[model samples]
Target: MVMRWWSDRWTQSAGAFFLEKDAIFFASARDFLAGVLAAVVITCWNLAAVERNAIVQASQKPYQTLSSRYLYKTHKAKSGRNIHDASFRVYRSSPAMAELLLFEDIFTITGIDTDGKKFDKVSRIEARSEQFDMQLVLDVNIDVYPIARTDKFTLALSSTLRLDGTPDDGVFDQSRKKSLADKYEYVMYGKLYKYDDDESGGAIKIGVYVSFGGLLMMLKGDKQHLGNLKLDQRLYLLMRKV
Candidate 1:
């Protein structure tokens, strides 16, 4: 019944949009839409903090470095491919240093017209900025199914921390930063989602496990993790923030 209703609705919408007198209008609208789509930019939001906004902040110490490790596993698959597998670690080094360690691993990718294949690579991502700069830098390669290839581009990933409105004042809130620093050792879990065409595309969800609450809350790395997320795969991330 749901399928039938969807089909009927699509048919009706298409018919109405393509009515005999609507051809010219449809063409113009399509061109306008294409242009708008080209101009629209893609930004990744922090799903963890957004979804768990009601969770009380637990950190009260000064902002410091945290670390952890986990087994990275993929529980979701698409087309003719299976999930990927890997090991992750975040070392405890310095208060100013934030590191995400991704060990060597194999990932599966299924193309639009071909069988799935496996690719393996190693990488490390770190944020050295004392304040949020919208861009997060990392030295790593990522693989998303159907379009399997390392991100050879030398560009730092971008992140949007505040969800309420533009923070015209400053990037980091001192009180909030202190809370994160205090609770730096807390355990946190989050889900990463991929929205391909902004509001047009459905979300592709990925699970993330963080050992350090500061990583997810303080450094705000969760906001930028979506840069390497894939729509065709469900990623189970076991990560630490050090």
Candidate 2:
């Protein structure tokens, strides 16, 4: 009888010990799960805050209309020079020699114009660019498109108006086909006749010259911007006011 009573007491002690171990295990598991949940909540909150900040920053940034790939230059006109007094001797030379040698292909492109001066002809205007502090002399057909002083504009030289970068047949289409020129107010067909690099104001400047019929354009600036231009290539000059 004494042995049986001792066995019962040992069984009770064993059961109590097992129950205490189970309670400790459950408590630790619950605490671990709660920590995990708290970490997840904190991480989600941080991500959401970051996204909200990004949206705010984007909204505050200025909107840019033109893509850098096709844009050749952007300028605000400082002043209008005297067209009559402005020498066209540098740009007046005929482009026929270059035009006669190359075949034409069209591709997508766009830009803006800044300041203008009416030349000897009522239909023509001579202009310059101001943004990059570069030397620019541009001649446009005022009869076709008029540009005033202190105007802000961008210019692009493109081979075609196709957005897909495919070459267009050298034919004018009046169809519903959308083109890069649609975004611009003034458009002209021209050929890049010359490209030159020279030192100006203690800096190296690259020059691009193009002729639209008899109208001419000379853009001289940093090479990083004008490096894509090719000589004797047919291009479309697109311009719009900002």
Candidate 3:
């Protein structure tokens, strides 16, 4: 009987403690529910904030509302371009860079057309650099398109960087002034089908496609020779200097 009485007292005491804390527990529950509702509302609102017209609309806003508008301004429909297109980069070279190509002996390679037009040096060789010109070694390459194909021929080849007065890679580490033409394995492409002048001496036709390889070197020749390089770890071809 005593044990049963003590058990009833313990149960009553536990109930009283729960009643006392009920107010605080209910307040906490309300707070937790409000927090959950606020978080869901915020997430939904944020998702709606992102839109496809974001760039165009955002670009029109003031600096206070959208500080990043200036960068995306060009993305507008009328602009139709990107900011990166405006600027570019290139490497530095030595004053005497390196003579990458040198024709020690260029002989009497002459020809005449049937049209009564006399030509002196007729054997034309095509190299990799778009700016390469044996007559004026400076334009050997540029940042423009090197490979081209017209009604005549499709030319393609490469050359190694000539490291002489400067480093081969054209980095601005050491400043040396000189044209550096390093040794290059000159390559040329020729076609099998040949071209010959008419009996009346018309235009002379050339081969369809042929390949040639020779030892040509590059030194620190000129800095402005190649307009811009494609950036290395690639096969660069140079032409033989006749």
Candidate 4:
């Protein structure tokens, strides 16, 4: 009878121990599941917030889609090979240049053909920014769109002429619907080939180079002015004498 009594006590103790252990295990599992659920909720909320912000930005400026700024100073192009070949070769030394390639977009002509004519129809123009003090070396088709020294012009760079900021279709659009091009006098389409940063001057300087069917352009300035540009982007250069 004593042995049986002892057996009953031990069985009760073992049962209590196992019940307590099971309760602990279930409680931990429940806490882990709750943490995972909370994390998922937070992640979803963050993604929704980002989407809302993007929508707001897109709607804020529906008509003004191009990246633009004003430029006022100018300089002459250095005499050398064709502007296209010269700019390409300079950046081609970098592997990124081989892989790929605007404006608040205004500039004033400072110097024109300071060296000499590189091409009969194309004249290299040196220009400067009125606001940012950026420098530009551009080749214009003089026979088609004549630009002279001391000319004040607004230049805009855009991926698409559409005011709605759509991606370019890569086909020449004959549609006469008013576009960003309609507001400009001269326009050229090109692809950005290279982007580089130079720190030799103590301050960082950025260089952006593009080619419009061999008509070349180089823009150099601080990061604030060129930060929006991306490599290998197709761009439209729009200009109007302001």
lDDT of 4 by residue, 164-233 (tens): 6667686778977756665456789998999999898798999999999999999998987687788998
lDDT of 3 by residue, 1-242 (tens): 99999999999999999987997899999999999999999998877777645755744532110111111111233353222212112323222322332111111212212234222322232222222221211122211212112211112232333443222442322444422221211233221122122233352322111122221222111223322322222333333221
How good is model 1 by TM-score? Answer: 0.16
- For model 4, the superposed segments whose C-alpha errors exceed 4 Å read 1-102
lDDT of 3 at 192: 18
Top TM-score model: 4
TM-score of each: 0.16, 0.49, 0.22, 0.57
Full-model lDDT, candidate 1 = 0.31
Indicate the residue-level lDDT of 133 in model 3: 26
- lDDT per residue as tens, model 1, 155-235: 111122232222223234555533221222111232233233222225332232222212221122233443444333222
Ranking by lDDT: 4, 2, 3, 1
Q: By lDDT, is 2 or 3 better?
A: 2
User: Model 1 clash pairs?
Assistant: 59-179, 59-182, 59-183, 60-182, 61-182, 66-242
Model 4 earns a TM-score of 0.57
Model 3 TM-score on a 0 to 1 scale = 0.22
**By the lDDT metric, which is better: model 1 or model 2?**
2
lDDT of all predictions: 0.31, 0.58, 0.31, 0.70
Q: Work out how many backbone clashes candidate 3 has.
A: 63
- lDDT for model 3 comes to 0.31
